[model samples]
Target: MKKAIIALALLASAGIQAQDIYTPGEGEGIIYFLPKTQIVVDIIATRVDYKPGEFGLYANRYLRLNNVSTRPETHWEIKDIQVRTAGIPDSTKAYIMKLKDKSLESNIELTDQGIAKAINTTSSYKEEQPEYKLQIPQKHENAHQYMTEDILVAGSSAKMAELTAREIYNIRESKNAILRGQADTMPKDGASLKLIISQLDKQERALTESFTGVTDRTDKVFTFTVNPEDKMSDKVFARFSSRLGVLQADNLAGDPISISISNSSSLPAPVEDGKKKKKIDGVIYNIPGKGKVSVSFQGKIKWENELQITQFGYTEVLVDGLFDKKVNTRVVFNPVTGGVIKIDKD
Candidate 1:
């Protein structure tokens, strides 16, 4: 009879233990297991906006654990956290604000699945209520914003696994000088281990960024110049000169201007002996007072393929009698098309 009673008590205890097990997406808010930990966490955020060129995320978390073992009661504490930006290549620009405690450790892990899980689980978490609002001048035309809060709870066994994986990964891939050789040499439960793990997380974040290819390309050089006075001499030159001078001072203050010039003649056929023929259509010049001068050539010539001008001209007259003049005297000719590729001021 005593043995039956003891068996019932043990079964009841096991039932309680089963109920205490933490499962991903089981509790309220955004809570998930950290690889191999018994920690249960809840995360909440509000007014989160996901937009191109503009994004904002605010989150808060709470953590706790249930003691179900007969051994010395164990307490679980959130020692650190790891947040990742996943999927979209450069979507990690949004910064975490007001980290609860600076002394708390943090890391960024880069498994392909880590980000995907976070994003997918985001919808399961509840949005947090707003505490306050501030009036600020709007900078972007269409900027969206939001706020959030969260909670996290974990168990002792799970927490141990989290620590173990972090240690192993740190020892293998971490680049921190202090963590070198110390992974195996340091006391397992000491503060040094925590510090090393924190550094490892930071290094992981940098590695993820490198792999995402988020660095902008800003080293390419592009340069071109125009001449407004070339090939202009008569009424055509006067009108164009006045228009360009006024446009530069008003509409073209910060704009790219397009210039197009083509020959108005045709080229003759090639002669016998298989030698390539040459054709001169017209000469384009940059005369300061004449604007742009286009002298047409005679005969049936292929102007597009033969006679081409190198330099164009530009002129800007100032109200104080100071003339702002620019000339494209250097011509980059394309041999295949017999055309000008680029023109610049000499």
Candidate 2:
């Protein structure tokens, strides 16, 4: 879709009320929207599952494996946490740009959400959502895939376990022989020798895992969106359990994971004058306030950073007469923070 000016109307004079410039659903002019910052938290957790081997009971006797677990088990762990910011259109900050001259129409640029990105200059804003992905474990080969014909067709579980253990030892011996350069027929190169040893090690591990069991792991991401207007202390956003992994905040299955926000804005608090203050009439933009955000789990801080929060700060406007036909002005805005990036006039 075309992304720029929506509608335009010539203003009679510059003495217009500031409220008229931003009042919703009013005049026919270029309707543009300001942006608000949204905090995104991505939690990555890993789930581990262990499957007991079919011949686990005979593992200790045949392979000398000690304390091999015969029961299946499942558990979860928090691997990582990532924080990012996204911009969304703020309906309350929508405004209309009514200019006396229509010559600047061709130089305006805006995002799809009607957030002003640049005027009389090039902008690199691409209206796209963030990408998320979850990784899953791949299927692993079964012990039978690496078993010898005699071992596969063994009459009893005890015999099969012994035969498998012998095969694993054989693979290990072959790898050692190649590594020691004592094999009857050696590989032509170091790369070939490495490949042969790696295959042998893989086959040995598959055979051994049949007795010791196998643990499979997969990673999943959980996302939470936050919009902050003030300071927040120890707000529980999610939970984590060793048995269930990530859970909702209301879920009692896990322990609480919290987030804390502290406003660090340098802007003075707004004063209430007896007369009502009007919204600015000129090129309006935000002077975003700074804030520190942190995440904690299990009584320990995990991640923290400072970010620009559009809601914490006040708004300001460029001086009048900057957009006149006689002046050549260029302005670039940070849509995420609603703050001006650059301003130039010739």
List residue ranges in candidate 1 displaced over 4 A. 1-181, 185-203, 206-254, 258-346
Worst window of 10 by summed lDDT in candidate 2: 10-19
Please tell me which predicted candidate would have the highest TM-score against the true structure: 2
Cα-based lDDT for every prediction: 0.23, 0.78
For all predicted structures, in order, the TM-scores are 0.16, 0.87
Per-residue alpha-carbon lDDT of model 1 for 126-185, expressed as tens digits? 224333232222322111111111101224434433433343345345444445653335
Instruction: Enumerate clash totals for all models, in the order shown.
Output: 54, 1
User: Residue 28, candidate 2: how far off, in angstroms?
Assistant: 1.5
Per-residue lDDT of model 2, residues 1-346, tens digit only: 2345434433122334322445544555566677888888899898999998877998888888899999999999898888777779988887666544534533567787777888777876554665656667766667898998999899998889889888988888888888899999999998998889888878987888888888888888889888875679988999999998899999988999998888898878667788976565476788888889999999999899988888888778775557655787888888888888888888
User: TM-score for model 1?
Assistant: 0.16
